[model samples]
Target: MHGPLKGLFAWRFVVRAEDDVRHPDGRASTSLRQGVRHQDPEPIVANFILDTASPHTKVCPETLIALRYNGDMRPGQSATVIVQGVRTPCVVGRPGEANSIGAPFIVDGSLTFYFDHRLDAPVLYVDDENADLRCRAYR
Candidate 1:
């Protein structure tokens, strides 16, 4: 239920910053709150452009510039973006860590887009066990 997207169109879509984290007291956190380190409502939802040529997924340069990123995108250095969405510690990254102007992934570089031209609807397979978001691109 997550791949083999077949079509003849440029790839692009909106990828959401998952609200998968919970606070110590079991609260959901998102960027739509205040007092969080990177409190802002604009980044929770952003755009993803398919670019198989680049080596790894990266934030849009301008977005990073706007966030004034200073090595915050480094490995093992996550921030507490929205410390409290509804009432917990969640949300991560700056304003541009999710956008991909070029590239697809860094640590998990297993995504590849192929057009078989024989299927319908775009699909995304998040291989959680293997931590892979590998998928075929479509709309």
Candidate 2:
């Protein structure tokens, strides 16, 4: 399939530390506010952290339950994920409580991290094909 670069594929979100929150009473909250999103028709739309070190992409059990996805567990299952208009075939698996997109999605795709020297914030870039190689190499 074609890559995200050919389509509109990009997501942006805010990040805050656990200790960096203000309560209604103007008190500092110690709990972390994890990034999350929900959309209709699709059933579930939770925020996921991209982990380049991880070997496989995984979704939280809660997300699967929320989606009401009743597929066979044997050998896992494949799902078509439409990101920025690009339909991608992804292998779904159960991992921890948090949803994470790992190297499995990146090895064949292109990734770029934008960082500013003055800020700790970063922006992630994804493309269907490896920009460096111009195409995905399979062994």
CA shift of 40, model 1, Å: 11
- Tens-place lDDT digits, model 1, residues 71-121: 234432332221111111112334444443333242243334445546653
Tens-digit lDDT track of model 2 for 1-139: 1353322222332211112334569986322223332212243346665666777655544554454444332234654333322223445666544455666555445666665457544566664444545422210
State the lDDT at 46 in candidate 1: 36
Scanning candidate 1 in windows of ten residues, the lowest lDDT window is 82-91
Best by lDDT: 2
Which regions of candidate 1 fall more than 4 Å away from where they truly are?
1-35, 38-43, 61-121, 132-139
